[model samples]
Target chain A: MEKTWNNKAWFMVLPVLVLVAFSAVIPLMTVVNYSVQDTFGNNEFFWAGTDWFLDVLESDRFWDALTRNLIFSAIILAIEIPLGIVIALNMPKKGIGVPICLVLMALPLLIPWNVVGTIWQVFGRVDIGLLGRTLATLGINYNYVQNPLDAWVTLIIMDVWHWTSLVVLLCYAGLVSIPDAYYQAAKIDGASRWSVFRYIQLPKMKRVLLIAFLLRFMDSFMIYTEPFVVTGGGPGNSTTFLSIDLVKMAIGQFDLGPAAALSIIYFLIILLLSWIFYTVMTTSDAQG
Target chain B: MDFSWMAWTLPTALFFLAIALMLVGMGVWEYVSPGGNPRVGVLRFETTRGDRLFVSLLGSAFIHLAWLGLVGANLWWALALSAIYAIGVFRYV
Candidate 1:
């Protein structure tokens, strides 16, 4: 059958275009407008060129927050990807157990991010929280409120508890899509368990793994609400990722120009890094 | 028509206009010459004309940003560097 190019087909896409314009483009334009201007608090503004971008780029505070964000994202990807794969591998393939496992895995991801943070905030309290009191009873000086390391540990664990389920579900979906024929063939070949996984399972899961990696990376990189609620970027700016810093600059201090510039820079960094990750992963996937 | 609430400035508006123009131009170019003829280059991944354009634009942004960060606020040299980078991307990438 031959395909016809109809101009009316564009009408189908018009709704999405309008929605995107309203949701993304308008807000982004407002940010861009603020980025290169100085405001004197009377709704009066003046052109400032790239001065704010320069200031944000030069500021140690901005750099420190960016560094923390990158490190946090790296640690998350490191922990979640493998942990999700392991959990997915262990998940029962069929019967009543499958639905139960899936529902259990999905429960954490269904919770709101702020709610997850709030849960951890109370759950890590030394006086009342289970984990904190247990550690305290074991002679561990665990105080997320007072110690930076403890704060980081709590945040990372909370994030893992919250988001690892997403990876598990994606990987499990990928794993379940594999047919019985492949396994039968592997068994006939008398392949070792590791060999079967390396050759059959890993290759099958590559696409979902890539999706999981990108989603996790982007989400972890822009993480704000969870850490903000849990730590409030406190213990003296220890957990202040880029979003938290941008908020503090924009709303907290009312430095609209610099904050807007920082937002642009932050968005660009994520775009650039995600593109790089996509390119690299897909390239490797094509080759191997 | 009342963009006063947005606090739009001349330079910023012009900047957005230029970007919109580029996107329109790209659309026109694609309509005229479809397929884009993806090819592998220095990056070792297949990319079409639009991909190269995106890469160049993204690179140019970073170059300008780095210039602002490392050197002074004068952006003439940064613009020059970005133009060269765009040409290189179109040619090679």
Candidate 2:
């Protein structure tokens, strides 16, 4: 398609640019300012160089949080992708079932973030919550607050409950769009079910799958509120992800300099990973 | 999150003023670039610029909601995810 290649196109993007400048650029500049400068009472400020950055880099707490973040993200992607595909495949493709399935899937997504966290937090309480009570009734010990393993388990379950619908919805969209002719041709060729899916459905779903993967990865890596609400990064900081740690530093303890430095590093990591995802997905899309 | 800044800071007021100017600027851009050929993308039909923008905005909303659901409330992750979504929209809608 021939585009006009007009310098006027810049004007079309102007609104987004302005919005980003306010929402992103300004906040980022503030963070950057805080990173290099130290403030005391009455807003007195002095240059601090990279001292804060160095401190954060050397801290074991930072390293531990980063590791926890990576592990959680890895676990989520591994489970959600395959599980979502399976659930999407099994969902009714037609009739009243389709809308029902869609509505059910979308319900979890409509809930607010903190509400989801609160729901799970109460839902997992060993003494009163359904999950906790059921486990106790069965003579099983499950205390997310006191047990590191249980805290990890509860957090993972809460995340899965909340996010698996996204993968299902995206996959369902891909699945529903697969033309009937593809399946008819597969049937005519007497292709095995696995072969049919492998050659047709899976290939057709690649774009959405790429989207699901990258979206999940970025979200999981930066996860905070749910775990913060659920475990409070508890059981001795075992579940403390980077975002939580950053908040604790910046807001909890009011360590602006180190927190700002950490925030920059955190932003850079997500940017790097997202860039890699975009490049790989787009190049593969082009080749395909 | 706080709108109090708008009342206190010149920079915040400038942001809103910039947004108003941008809306008018975009109308001019459309007028100058009379006809734009719709591009074929991941969607079944070809999409014009507005179509692409709409899809991305909707897609990015879900991405953010899902992030808050499964992950947390860190805006940086949302920004990164939005970046990927914008690339996808531009590349394939």
True contacts kept of each: 0.79, 0.00
Q: Give the C-alpha lDDT of model 2.
A: 0.81
> For candidate 1 chain A, which ten residues in a row score worst on lDDT?
A40-49
List candidate 1 segments past 4 Å from native.
none
C-alpha positional error of residue A210 in candidate 2 after TM-score superposition, expressed in Å: 1.1
B34-85 per-residue lDDT for model 1 (tens digits): 8886899998999999899899899999999988888889989999999999
Each model's DockQ score: 0.81, 0.04
- Each prediction's Cα lDDT score? 0.93, 0.81
List model 1 lDDT by residue over A1-288, tens digit each. 999989799999999999999999989999999999999688898888898998998899999999999999999999999999999999999899999999999999999988999899999999999889999999999999999999999999999999999999999999999999999999999999999899999999999999999999999999999999999998999999999999999899999999999999999999999999999999999989
lDDT, candidate 1, residue A245?
Answer: 95
Cα misplacement distance, residue B84 of candidate 2 (Å): 28
lDDT of 2 by residue, B30-51 (tens): 6788554476666545566655
What's the CA error at residue B80 for candidate 2, in Å? 28
